[model samples]
Target: MIDGDDVGKRFAVVEHPMQPRALAAPMHRHHREDEYSFVLEGRIGAMLGDTVVIGNPGNLIFKPREQWHTFWNAGDTPARVLEIISPAGFEHYFRELGAELSNGPPDPQRLAALCARYALDMDMSSVPGLIQRFGVRFPGGPSPAPQ
Candidate 1:
């Protein structure tokens, strides 16, 4: 609910509502901002590098910049989390991504460019394996083959 500018760019708060079994994004890492997610409802499962952890309500998960990580709603019910991104800026990436998705499926090149602009690295190839291994659902239909 708080923008980076309002907080002098030290941090920004964004609320994320996750559907049951939803995977938030493909495996990815940020080069500029660290994120801390506080679980507000339901369970959240996250993978930081090769380590996996689960957080329930009242739990906070830390994801440092440059770490390959991803998180998903790990429950049968809806989930919500408050994300705090430090040194600001990265929250805008979510806004842009949402707008792109609103148009329909995103073009791979455009998505790549967007991520690059945000100093983010994504592993689209990891989607299928994550879905199968964790029983989570990626937003777009059909899993892409691992490259």
Candidate 2:
């Protein structure tokens, strides 16, 4: 695990452990950072714009800045990944979002403010279709297939 500061703000690494069929986030894009997800276990499915791709263990998936994208655990087992965010700072958004989520279902206004502060653009409406199409489950959404 590495922080942007440790890397002179070039990049930050965060480990994500996902439950079976879990959708990591709504379709979103960053204005200032690119993301690289390296699968460590199980399967990861990602949608970059209109194209969908899957990454298995040892595979890397790149999501460039300003591209609409979202990823999910595509298997009926736990999944793990290392996310590398370039040019730093976006990891703080994750930290803040985690805190907001810890307070139960987040207040929409606050969530929007958080996204705005991080230069993130999210399409909440795309969530349902993503869930349905991939048979994935967003947090607080339908239960995933039995593990």
* Candidate 1 structure lDDT: 0.93
lDDT of 1 by residue, 1-147 (tens): 999999899999999999988899899999999999999999999999999999999999999999999999998899999999999998899899999999888999999999999999999999889988888889975642232
Could you tell me how far off, in angstroms, the CA of residue 132 lies in candidate 1 after the best superposition? 0.4
Candidate 1 TM-score versus the reference: 0.95
* Residue clash pairs of candidate 1: none
**TM, every model:** 0.95, 0.96
Per-candidate Cα lDDT values, in order, are 0.93, 0.93
- Top-scoring candidate (TM-score): 2
Alpha-carbon RMSD of each model: 3.2, 1.6
User: Model 2: how far is 124 from its true place, Å?
Assistant: 0.6
Query: Stretches of candidate 2 above 4 Å error?
Result: 144-147
Residue 100's lDDT within candidate 1 is 93
